[model samples]
Target: MTYPVDLIIVGGGPAGIEAALAASHKGFRFILVEAGEIGASIRRWGHVRMFSPWEHNTSPLGRKTLAVHGHPVPDLAAVPTGAEYLEHYLHPIAQSPELAPSIRTGTRVIAVGRAGIGKSDLIGDPRRADHPFQVTLARAGSSDPVSVVEAPILIDASGVYDQPSPFTEVAVAQECEASVDHYIPDVASQRGRYAGKHTVIVGGGFSAATALRDLLPIAAEVAGTRISWILRNADRKPLTAVRDDVLPERARLVEEINRIATSADVPGLTILRGTRIRSLVQLPIEGGSTDGSGFELSLAGDHAGTLTADHVLALTGYRPDTALLAECQVHLCYASDGLMKLSAALLGAMGDDSAADCMAVPAAGIETLRSPEPNLFVIGNKSYGRFSHYLLRSGIEQVETVFDALPAPVRTAK
Candidate 1:
């Protein structure tokens, strides 16, 4: 099934929604695809609220939607809870006439090949099975033949949080001791791919904290599987403080882990605090170095001394999934922070309008969002990777830019 819309949006998060509205006002037809339910993070992390408020989430177009519908404006600076952001804000914005019809939820996009049809002026990597521009979706109701959406304009609003590969993969190889392997093995095999293993996790951010809080119980239930919580910092602790924002959910997570930690009784469940991983040592054997099929790690400590383990879980952090960009052949200027900057500098580059700051990426690595191909552009969190507030502001910048690119309808003198 091939349906060509004016534009095809690959993500339905804050960027996707806002971009749709901007496209609509510009009078270009578009379709939006979301792999999970809309606002996946908000739904998955429903227990917590956003650090920024509702006003920040609302777009110029979004604000107009509220006004036309007779809805009162929300506090601009109030960061909404995850649930509130979804129910009150995201849902509302997505339902605007600007969206809805073209929004295909539960549609997960696999690959975005470089477009040949429109011959995009934007600069970036070339897509694999090139087309004018195509978006392939994995959805239940999709016809037997499957659906292939072709658009002149494609926006890669897909964010990074979704691609949590595996803590093991993210681990710095040198940090592993002679016997250590994998930073977090469980996340690598769990569910989609990373699951069912003695996974080690190390990080001080919200992602690490959430994974630990939720995955402990599941690990305990399984007979031999285990979880080793290790962190490198002053004093033995759970890396960062359990986020107080999630209050009840955070407490529940801690409570469940406590019970499991006490009952698992298996010495296998160890929490190495105040120590850092030294390196991963592969024991040499006739076939290959085999300490454990999936276990091995050596660690060093500031005051706690050094140790060894089967696998290490280093939730140090994540950069954007820039690997996918390689496939698309997108030209990326590396930011000190790893965010990709667009190529074309904005028409209105800067001003006191605060929002205009995102107009052009002033960062070193980030130059412009221009893809290697013409007419191809990226949006959402990806657009604001390093320089600007990676939140929603950069998304707005993308929305307006793409909308402006499309040909506008000429006025008729009555």
Candidate 2:
């Protein structure tokens, strides 16, 4: 059956935008949908500067596309904050003639599946590709009537930032989630909330490190300000510094944060290693009301005990949301929740000593981008699932790989 378009791309971030550009270049009819504005997730952490320079953050196709439209190129050596990257690169690409016409913002893809078949019907049969994919769409975050669109191919580039991992291995407490800051907080602007307050920070990744780095000066400047850092691992240095790191900014951040974790000399800073939050209760403030004024936490592990704080920073990273593809037969890794073949490739590289650094990860081949269901691809950070090492460069490469493998458009371009 003929579909409305040759392909449907879900997401409007770097990967999705790049895919749309590729689709246009390949002379295919395609639609790119974004749940929010382009680069919405990036805008959330816009204040933080990226470790990778502009060279690695953008795609060659994207740059070429923008250049052809007379858009100025960014300095390749310059590292951009999330805001700058969004404004200068992603936003422009989305608005470029190549992609703008096919893009839809504030439209969420609620579900996707073969139009006439259930997940079990095809069972590895080549006949499966004959059916068009039915994508359910609706206004983002609303319960209005849904619209279904059909496409022969679907590429899910939707990223993971919208879904943050809970602070513990088990389910998160509703009270804890409602009270803590999940995303990296803009400490400078939110000084009124963080200043002179005791904060307990959770997690061991770069997000956590960034929060710690940002809050240190605030703690020093504000009288009675205190910070208690909680790491799930017992390592003295929570962040691993790449040997002879290629990204100087990332290396410096690791070194600085690790130094703070090891030195124990920074006043108003307390590092609690190998700790977890067992329970958290909002305590009543001076007037005997639980208005989010304070928290009493029951801790577990190496530094197990009761602790009190005015704020909690749970920068524990994120995982991909796979619910939208529930009706499709996609193979996901048991551990990472990443596409199976790609996850195996990533895991294999991670096991090797030489591939210790994220930069050393092996490039994803076209085969790794394919799923059990034919003509469906999961690219970008979502393809990495819970893996935290996805570089923007990798997503660009994935877009190229997937498009290259797809068949040329059967009908005239829209």
Candidate 3:
């Protein structure tokens, strides 16, 4: 099946929802394709709370959209968990009558390219600009055909949650796969699985800190349980205590993690800094049997030692999934931070500690959002690529900029 539309928006998360709303307001018809439920990525990290409060997280436009549906405004200062952000704001905006019809959940976009032209032909084809985009879609789980949609514009808002950066890019022993948890589970609910187990948590970001802090209490309660925290940066310090932060919860979390790291007095907790995993080998379980039961890691760097664990939680980071956009021949930075044109801006912003925050990096404007492929742009977290600074507020601002910069609509003859 094929449907012609004015714009095709990929992803159904916060950015995609904002794009759909912007398109609707601009009088352009669009369809949003999502591989899973709306806010699926956030749902994965629902147990984690956001550092920014509701006011900073939501946009004026989103509020208006929700208001149209008779939804009441939430407390501006309340910082919501991932679940609350989805339920109280995003879900309602997505379900609003104006945006609901355009949303297609559980539909994954397989590929995107120019209609009637291949990637090789896009360079010299004079008709390429006039040609519509061919977007291939398939059912979430099934291989069966769903439909091919054609549109003049394509917005790639797909974020990075689907792609997890491996602990080591090198090939892993097949046996090590079974002991890893890519996504953090609700530790409280899954305490039994972790009780009395030796676990290693990798990475040094907020996620890593959260995992360590959450596990501290469990370690105290469960006998024989041990925790290993590994970080690549030897110079990295504990989370800063943000006493005057607008969001007190985030401030509290930061202080808690800071205390744990600075004191180094937590029982059953060990910190390994400036370490890298050289190799992972399965450990023998019991009498004459190796069923990939446990594992040991050969390490390098400052620690320069091996560690054994019953379970490994790698909270490293994520990167954008650009496989779907390959067919469209969109230009991405060699560093994979964002569009090639954005290198200077992103780099410049990074040099300034305060500006490193994606929200602090001034709105790149809709012009900055464009890729080599005309009318195709990437927004939201996906736009940041490997850069971890992107904020929800920045994504919302990008949506407004895109709408503001949209060209005037063409009228059809009667």
Runs in model 1 lying further than 4 Å from the true structure: 1-3, 70-72, 114-131, 140-145, 169-201, 206-315, 319-327, 333-367, 384-389, 405-414
The lDDT for every candidate, in the order shown, is 0.57, 0.87, 0.81
Task: Point to the candidate with the largest lDDT.
Answer: 2
For candidate 2, the TM-score is 0.95
- Per-residue error (Å), model 1, residue 107: 1.5
Worst 10 residues of 2 by lDDT: 168-177
Ranking by lDDT: 2, 3, 1
lDDT of candidate 3?
0.81
Q: Count the backbone clashes (under 3 Å) in each candidate.
A: 71, 0, 0
lDDT by residue for model 1 (255-282), tens: 5554543453644466666666554444
Model 1, TM vs. native = 0.60
TM-score of each: 0.60, 0.95, 0.91
Candidates 2 and 3: which is better by TM-score? 2
For residues 139-231, could you state the per-residue lDDT of candidate 2 as single tens digits?
Answer: 989856379889888999999999887776455557656877888888879988888889999998889999999999988888989999999
Question: What lDDT is obtained when candidate 1 is compared to the true structure?
Answer: 0.57
